[model samples]
Target chain A: MSSTRKSQVQSSKVASEQIKTQKDIDMESDEDRNDENRNDNQQQSRPKLSIQRQDGDNTNATYSFLNEDHTLGNLLRNVIIKNNQVEFCAYSVPHPSEPIMNVRLQVAPSCGDTKKVLKHGLKRIAKMSDVLTEKFQNALDKYENRMSD
Target chain B: MYGMEQINTATGFANAKFGSSKGQGAKGFDEPEIRILELSKYVIKFELLNTDLSVANSLRRIIIAEVPTMAIDLVEVKENTSALHDEFIAHRLGLIPLQSFNVDQFNLSDQCACSSMCAQCSVQFKLHAVCSDRDQMEVNTRHIQPLSDAPIIPVQYVNDKGIEEDPILIMKLSKNQQLDMNLVARKGNGKIHAKWSPVATCQMRKEPIVEIDQDKINRDLDIEKRKEFVALCPREVFAFNDYRNAVEIENSDKCIQCIECLRFAQANNLERAVKIAEREDKFVFTVESTGVLTPEDIVSRALQILMRKLYELGTQMKKYGVNAD
Candidate 1:
């Protein structure tokens, strides 16, 4: 009975040591935790865009868009640049593995709010794409009908 | 507003529908136009005019990466004696393009209500091949059978004579070797895996603009120089007109902006004799499909996805109260 109790104590001690190692492993794998967060974030389908304004400067800000790439980034940047109030606008994908795009904007002093320009750009792109969809559908129908004939 | 001034050629700037000028806002931009140049079973060439480069690039990117399609995502191997391992066979199965015209009927697996998989989110397929009589049996995509009534099937190609071509080969099995497996096809986009991409290639290029000053070339350079200048162009963009005895633009559209002829002319003291530039508003696009979907269907579906993204962003912006206008 004494031998069995000693063995049991050793096994319990090993179990506690394993738990400590598991915690250590978890602490080491911050990327895994971030990946889980990202997956959960995607599952939740939350709004992926956020804005960060510069300290004491409303005209200068950075827009962080999750789950976006160069496709939307370049489009929005080009559209915003068309606005005279926008001094400069550029976008970059921070990491290839991370689906995130950061668009830095600096507008002229005359335009104090950077979000307004961003909203305008998004609206413009929406309208442009809407018209493109209609036109593309029409063109496709015409081509198909012609081919059938 | 970003378009540089272009010198009109003899035939004029044919592709540019709307030219942007200085100080123009986004509201001044006109609606983009699409003209289908060529359409075939596997390839499509179209011209997108009156649009920014960003729009054209976005469409290309979306067509290649964002369009949803059905592909084998998971496999359950019950038995296998073939030379290939289970994971190897599973990977090969995943790369096979499946008929995805009705992909909208299925929901994305992650968004589905079922615990892991169901009819609404996945299509079940069974593949069984056994080689007993033949010395060696060549397993092809035709071995895959849809377990359910789902419309998903391996893409089949047909020749011009209405004859079926050779189906895609999955593996080869020797005598007495067999493979039995169950495949689950899920709807996904290329962003997850390239195997789910509907298009084989989606590419865009700016329309080339070429301008030649015939008078300047004839007066400034002699016959030998003119001949040398014409020979400098690799694309045959310039040809010497024997009847007129002057150098002329032969096929301006064929110019790839190599700038050989332009450099030659500049060396001969004719700076503005030849100019080459790409139009910012006009883009030529070519989309090739993997036979899972038609080129037209892929293009239209890509446009729909892009528009959906834009709408989502716009609505989110409104929700964030960013609309000052």
Candidate 2:
């Protein structure tokens, strides 16, 4: 029983050492994190968000969706362009393996909120889809009624 | 307001009438209405509303004649023993449409900055045809090679077989009928010669407004009478659908507003059967291109030229204090 207690103490010491080494490695990686932002005092305060804008100004904006695919991007583009205030909108996937879609939207001068416009367009599309499904169900019911007759 | 007595009948296209009776006339007067109906690779159809007939006619003329094109203007024959004469061959060569684009890059020979002909406004072509065999030989436009590196210059025509089409029969040769020549191509507008015209045909017509009263005709007339009524109008403006048992407007735009249907209705003792009214302010245009530039390009370029002239005139008027606005 005494020997067992000794082995347990040694194992606990090794585990603590591993924890210390892991902390050191993490700190090293933190130091290596982007020399450009290294001097930034607000780095710790910054929120870690996935989406980022590679390029843009007031009238134009280019957004990057890292994990999102092209299908959603294309659909969003098609719907957003329906607003008519969107002068030009296009999307591109850097590489097939990257699985990232970059959407570039240019809002007209008279337009207000680009983000709100995009959300509204998406909502409108969803509503249209719901209406289509409802219509389809009604048509199916009518067909069945006729068949029964 | 041509006394629209039976509007909102829901009878057949009663609701189709646009509420433009008052607004269209007043609003269209200030800004000339130009609506492009159909646009494709090489064809475009549009309607110009509230414009004078003279303006439309002039636009049509400008599309056909004012558009610039490149053509072989001069040819030097070094050797030719072909059956066709040199002048005839040169004339034929001058007419071949060389598929040209980037029109702004080149200028007319006279309009060029150079004192004389230069590469900026003129392209040189050289052709050499020699037949040593006893068999017959054919020579077409393909043989005429552009000396410059310009890709659009010789206007290559490819056939379905994926082979370069007939070089174009410049002249047929029998054994020793060899032809060698140097040709010069220059930029020219169709105003000088129709060979440079970009448009094949540009036509405009007043827009036709078709009205149908199905309530009166369908309820009162028998099947045979209805069929007769459908067939009475020319241009096949209406068709009877067997499945729906309805007389529908197959192609309403073709209606010429001849009032023949109204006359037939009167003869058959029927009232308010069919009515067609031609909008005096609205017009429909049909444009087809000959080659090179597409119909859209031709129409847009014509409009651009027309607008430039207007802008220049306005500026000039401003100088003279004529109150051009």
Candidate 3:
């Protein structure tokens, strides 16, 4: 009877140890998952933003915005205003990894007194749109190249 | 007394028989009144003869006087030949070298005919020069014509010397050497004199006749006088119409079709409301006198005729107790 009791105690201790070891293994795995998630968050937050000037100052006024990336292109596609006066719409991601900012603008007539809403109001919005589009395409190209590398 | 009376009676009867019988016979004869017909025709004839002695003479005199004394100056040149050396050779041969070729600056006061075209007041210029050695020299110049024929003048200078003519220095004052001579003859014989027609004959067919809004006429007369065409028409035309609110034409037929009304409207800062059309049946009676007359004289005559008609109307109105004022 003593023998049987001692054996049973030893087996229970071993089982407990096994359970503790399992728990430790689970904790380590959870910690590893948390570290991976943190790394992912850091990568997302460090996205690069690019700015490009359309017409490059040659126009009456220049517009600058981030380069176009997936996010920027998506933002541009969401433009709602489609008026006769609205010339163009574009999205720019200043950095390849950054969020995109979409800009909508129009070419105002020379005679009217309406205050321009984009780029200090007086600046021609059409020219800015062109530059933003070019920079966005360039940024996408660069992002593709970086991915390939 | 009886003897005197008998003598006077015999003389009187003889005179009466001779005079009365001849007069009666002349009256009985059916002779055409050709002299009277000719006189009437003469009265209706229109002939114009004009002589602008002063204007023509003054222009001629100015041309003759101003052209010669014109001053010229050298402004620019391009070398094409060695004429400078040839000029030096000519100087060595005791010939005066043509030096410093340039235009004399023209001055009006130096003109001879007092602005008339006379032979005595003209000018000629000669220049001579010598070079130490045989070398090519070029000249470029700009000649300015003060009394430019037209508003703008263009001038160019070129040197036409060849290398073969070098060392000899034989530069001649050819007419080709003249860069630009813009001297305009001021003889006022042509278009200048023709442009100044006598005022009576030069009457522009169109005169402005003001037709105002009857209501506005009285209110705007003072302001209208300050307008550009106040003198374009007579003031009476601005009188009230039947409505007494606006002014209108008093006698539409009396209009001479002068664009005066249009001009008056334009002057008073108004739109062109009146139009002028030709009246074929109403002929313009022009008395072509031999001498010049002022435009005012002709205008006064026309106004006088208008005044006479107005006076007759006024007299009739007075008789009917119509208030002219």
Candidate 4:
């Protein structure tokens, strides 16, 4: 009886060891699956940004228009001036009811002509705003008409 | 007197006949001979020999008669446009979410006899755009053809906005531009295809048709049931035909024939009495191989079916004192 009891104890110890090892494997597999799922979710959720280079190089700085309330002056002041070009980026809003920030930068004939650059850049910016505003007004008129009907 | 000359340049002769001539003293007949020739400056010459000179002269007079000549001219025009413009318009109209667009190569060809490379009917353009938005956008394209009469091939454009499970946008060129492209084939052929313009096909509302069968219509004539069907209809095509005291399917012209109505009717036991007929004007609805029938034919057939069902329903409703609309 004692011998049989000893054998039973040994077998139980072996079975318990097996179960412990299997549980460890299962835990590792679960962690691996969780990691894969997280990676796939991140990849799917990330937004893809389209960038086009006007001059075929990063030298001609390009800015993305982010439809947000950020000021252009603040963005320019913060972003580093690289390769003699400054890029301004912004997002587009869903509706015209939202406020739009007008970012204007001066272009000087000579790099040293700061005053002329500022003047010319401001003028160009004004023209751009006028064109954009006209488009917005037309869109507003259409929306209002639809709402009335 | 007229001079006689041999015209050697003549390739063939017409209106010549051979016959035996008659001898004078012995009363013997002799064969008459004639030579036919063509001359320069719109003239034909004929010479007669032997006994029957009078017959040869008559043939010559008839042969020199004025002949008419005709001239004809043919002209053909060839046109081509760049496919990039289409992508640009789709992008601008929010049909293609800005982020989902990729700058993959695009190529298009039409049924022109020219090889796929010919300017008469081929276009290719490439674009690369990445979506930078949180909301998904849906784009549906309609009637992207060189001509308005040309067949419409469905194209899809989408942004990252993932708003709905099934999103679609419809696009078409303005009627005037489509007409001009069809008419002024030479000048307008290649110009319209090159660049994407903000034309009216973009940002237009999608009109869909819903057809209800007339056969299975419920005789109980519940006004609430009719209203429920109309409310469930995505296109609002259901209307009450007061004249027949029955539900009338309105705007059958807009039906894409998706068979949503059939499913609805089956579930509700709305009598299978209604026969839904698709509109002939749907973009992909093509004439059968027999040939294209006129609008009148399609309408008459639809009306015939509709009227028959209305009459049947009218007879049933008369027992209930309900008049057919």
Best by DockQ: 1
iRMS values in order, in angstroms?
12.7, 33.8, 57.0, 46.4
> What lDDT does model 1 reach?
0.82
DockQ of each two-chain model: 0.23, 0.01, 0.00, 0.01
Which residue pairs in candidate 2 collide? B140-B167, B140-B168, B141-B167
What's the residue-level lDDT of A56 in candidate 2?
Answer: 47
Candidate 3, B1-325: lDDT as tens digits: 1112111232221122112223223322111110001011002111111111221222222222211211221111222123333323222222111111111232232234455332232222222232324343322222122342221222221223422222223243332332212122111111122211212122112123334453454455554452323335454333344354445565553565556666665666555344545422122223221122222232223223223322443343344343312
Backbone collision count in every prediction? Answer: 0, 3, 63, 48
lDDT of 1 by residue, A38-95 (tens): 7767757855788888578888889989889999999888777766667778899999
TM-score of each: 0.83, 0.56, 0.15, 0.19
User: What stretches of model 3 exceed 4 Å from their correct place?
Assistant: A1-149, B1-213, B219-229, B232-264, B267-269, B272-275, B287-325
Report the candidate with higher lDDT, 3 versus 4. 4
Per-model TM-score of chain B: 0.87, 0.77, 0.18, 0.24
Docking class of 1: acceptable
Query: Which candidate model has the greater TM-score, 1 or 2?
Result: 1
Question: Can you write out model 4's per-residue Cα lDDT over A61-131, one digit (the tens) per residue?
Answer: 22222322232223222221211222322223334443333333322224432222222332322232333
Interface RMSD of 2: 33.8
Candidate 4 lDDT by residue in tens digits, B1-325: 0022122222111112111121322212222232322221112222223322222222222111110100000111121122224324432332221110111122222224555233333221222222234233222322222333322122233323733333334333322221001111111111122111111111111224344455446464376776666666566567766676567777765555566666767777664544565222112211111011121122123223223322442343344342212
Model 3: how far is B44 from its true place, Å? Answer: 3.5
Question: Model 1 TM-score?
Answer: 0.83
